[model samples]
Target chain A: MQIVVDLTRCQGYAQCVFLSPDVFQLHGQEGLLYAPSVPEDQVQRVRQAVAACPVQAILAGEEVAAGGG
Target chain B: MAGELRDGRIVVVGASLAGLRAAETLREEGFTGSLTVVGDEPYPPYDRPPLSKQVLIGGVPADTTGLPTRRDPDADWRLGVAATGLDLLERRVLLADGESLPYDRVLIATGTRARPWPDAGEAALDGVFTLRTRDDASGLAERLDAGPGRVLVIGAGFTGSEIASACRERGLDVTVAERGPAPLVGALGGTLSQLAAVMHRGHGVDLRCGVTVTALLGDGNERFVGADLSDGTRVEADVCVVALGAVRNVEWLADSGLAAGARGIACDAGCRAFNMYGIVTDDVFVAGDVSRFPHPLFGYQMLSLEHWGNAVAQAEVAAHNMINPGPLQRPHLAVPTFWSTQFGLNIKSVGVPTYSDHVVIAQGSLEARRLAVVYGYRGRVTAAVTVDMAKSLDYYRHLIETAAPFPPPPGAADRAIAADVPIPSDVPDPKGLSHEPVVALTGHLPDRRLMVVQPTR
Candidate 1:
């Protein structure tokens, strides 16, 4: 699975960080520090993080690689 | 536009967070239909929570905070237009432009607007501002950058406190006045609010609790200069921000006869709106800050929440129901979760604090500005609040979800010693609060919108 965050839309609400800490983290007061892709076992957590985002900034799917990976 | 056509035409009002999400969900849930979205704001859907924090402090651009769409909703957006009425018999949405959009189903996600100061003349003062729209934040940020001598904030709710926190972060002198005894008393109860009061004072915020700003004073040019307080004291500040809660955007639904009121348009657990006579409407649904729905955990009281999570959660549930049959429809039962960062502390809460009768410090201590307080009612855990202890919030959330016993059993904590003494939760009467609850239990307040209901009056 692939993870993508639209920096323009993210207001640093940190909803994604709380829901999927291993995949997304709040690096102090700077912003989110997250992995762009994760193993299949972590797909469920990544999807949950995407849905929980207030601004819908997080996107997770196989498209990250297919869109000219 | 992405989903296959499996159904009919759908209209979503208020092109903000909830409306945008619902439009997407309808497609994601296999609803193949033409969707139209109407919004009063000129811009496309944008993020608002940052208006008080980052935007005010110059960390982020005000006008550029647009929300990202995961997948195209393929919605025809009627921007800069308001929906005037809902003609149920004809199944059409009347717009301000005199055009009506016919729909098989409609979603109301109108959300809310900031409550302005009572006096129109006072509100017109040049330095007076209300933070709700991006424009408001951009204007205020420009003023803050000019290095005002002092900033007077008229409330101490989450938004108010966040603004003050931003002002302090910029090294500006700030004064906060609240009618309650302490900051955040209305939402987190007395004990926790006390910590908030101390944190503000410690961070050099001139916090005045148990007092209200009686009148806003201005100069000959109608520029705000100071404020007169109920405590017989006057605060001299060049810029005054009215952080007095919000007015649910339900005025357009006034004649819709869909159980709409100041408390907000009433909806059931499935996000189905109710009519004036208390009958649920099938074709009409409500979500976001505008909808008031009953929650079983909170004794079936209708909750009107302005939290970002509730808006997203309820929208998903409402959209799923809009596209599915009765047997497959899911209920909106997500536990309320809220978080705020101010005064250099990370505050987090889960469940409804107002629904509890007793509160105990399950972990940490207030003096340190780091603690987790668990709330219980009738021997069952109802809520949990943590300040600078964000990690432990989920632990307490577990207790509330399972209806754990009050004064939770010894050794429930990871600490050697835990403070579990029961005390009155001390949730204030919402009527006396100058600010609205970010997540409100509507039954307690005498009025919903703080301003005049009718202009003729």
Candidate 2:
């Protein structure tokens, strides 16, 4: 699955990080850092991260190769 | 019946603390149906109470403000996409990303946003800030740690007052400008606001009352430098915090045809959203700061509360009713409760004090800086506000709920005071001292706009 985040709206609440640390991370000064895509097996964890965000800033979806890779 | 219940789908917009709790409660109530939660921001649900206090004071790290959840509800979370509209007829929610989610039941818990500075250019300046989210606190905390020359805070609402308190706690020079005659007049009424003003002044706050910020000044690089007040006074400061108040997140529901606006989405006593025509739907419910519900204790007045306790309690009620049958449905009638720590005093309020016409010292003495002031309307207790006397709040809260007499029952022997304590006439208007009563009795206006819609022949 693919994850997309809008940095401007991301408040670094770290709720996503707490729910799915494997997918979402926090950088220095608690800035938001996350993986854009993950294997299918991790889809459930990624979805949990998305639901736990306070500001509701995380997005996830099925992976799709660009231009028919 | 179990299969039907399991087949139902519930969708909650606004992944706020209230929204998340409601979602958790739904499952706990044996809701095995599919659940979908939609939010505009990219991050998931997190705690907000600490953002203004502990996060600002640097006691707790900003990134660690996520609400402690006992367990996770496996649900589809559509984040980073705004819920643009609700199709009540179709039982679907339209997303900004061109996605539509169908649901059997919907919960509208979208909360409020900070009211930003009116001026675009000035608000865009570097040092201007508003505390509502974790990022806001982190940025402001960083600036405070950098030690600005002076911090100017406009508006003395709870959020504004807390920011100023944190500033003083950090030993940074701070100035507070309030448009109302006294600080917190909009929420607590005039008498308590005066005490709040005194508290702020006693703590060395450059407190200015009855003044509005006219303009914010910026340097050549468009960084905030100072501000100009309506009183024709120019003040120089390194940072400015606009804490005007909150704007309800109802614009997204504009096309949804729900009774949503600046006041918030109007809901029935049971938390059911009312359509534009005033019709209530069983499938759609609302909770938290976003939902304007009528309080029976306050003469069924529509109240939009920003209290933390109200949010959690109302969400649980809304969630329980959403799944339970009619006989088991209950109203969210919890007495409003909120507290603030400012200038070395703990201030707490029970009930809507603004709805009262008079305030009397019920216990303790104002001079002692520890007392409970009971607000009354026509001899009936309507609200209570306390300064460093929170332990007495629960008792007062019962008085408010029971519509107890104004003088109130005698306190414990240890806390007994003169029953005829002075009732000051210095209450200020929320709009301003020159304005009329802070709480107005506006007659009901039926959803006339909704009435105009004719059902298909």
Predicted structure with the largest TM-score when compared to the true one: 1
Per-residue lDDT value at A61 in model 2: 49
Write candidate 1's Cα lDDT for B273-380 as tens digits.
998878999889999999999988887889988778788889999999888767777889888887777877767788999888889888778866677888899999
As a whole number from 0 to 100, the lDDT of residue A48 in candidate 2 is 82
DockQ of 1: 0.08
**Poorest 10 consecutive residues by lDDT, candidate 1 chain B:** B448-457
Q: What does candidate 2's lDDT look like per residue over B84-202, in tens digits?
A: 88898899999999989899989999898888887788899999998788788889999998999999998888888888887887888998988777777777766677788887888
The CAPRI classification for model 1 reads as: incorrect
lDDT string, candidate 1, A1-69, tens digits: 545565434556788888787767653352454565465777788888888888787766432011100
- Model 2 chain B weakest 10-residue run by lDDT: B434-443
TM-score of each: 0.86, 0.82
* Model 1, residue pairs in steric clash: B6-B32
- The TM-score, computed over Cα atoms with residue i paired to residue i, of candidate 1 is 0.86
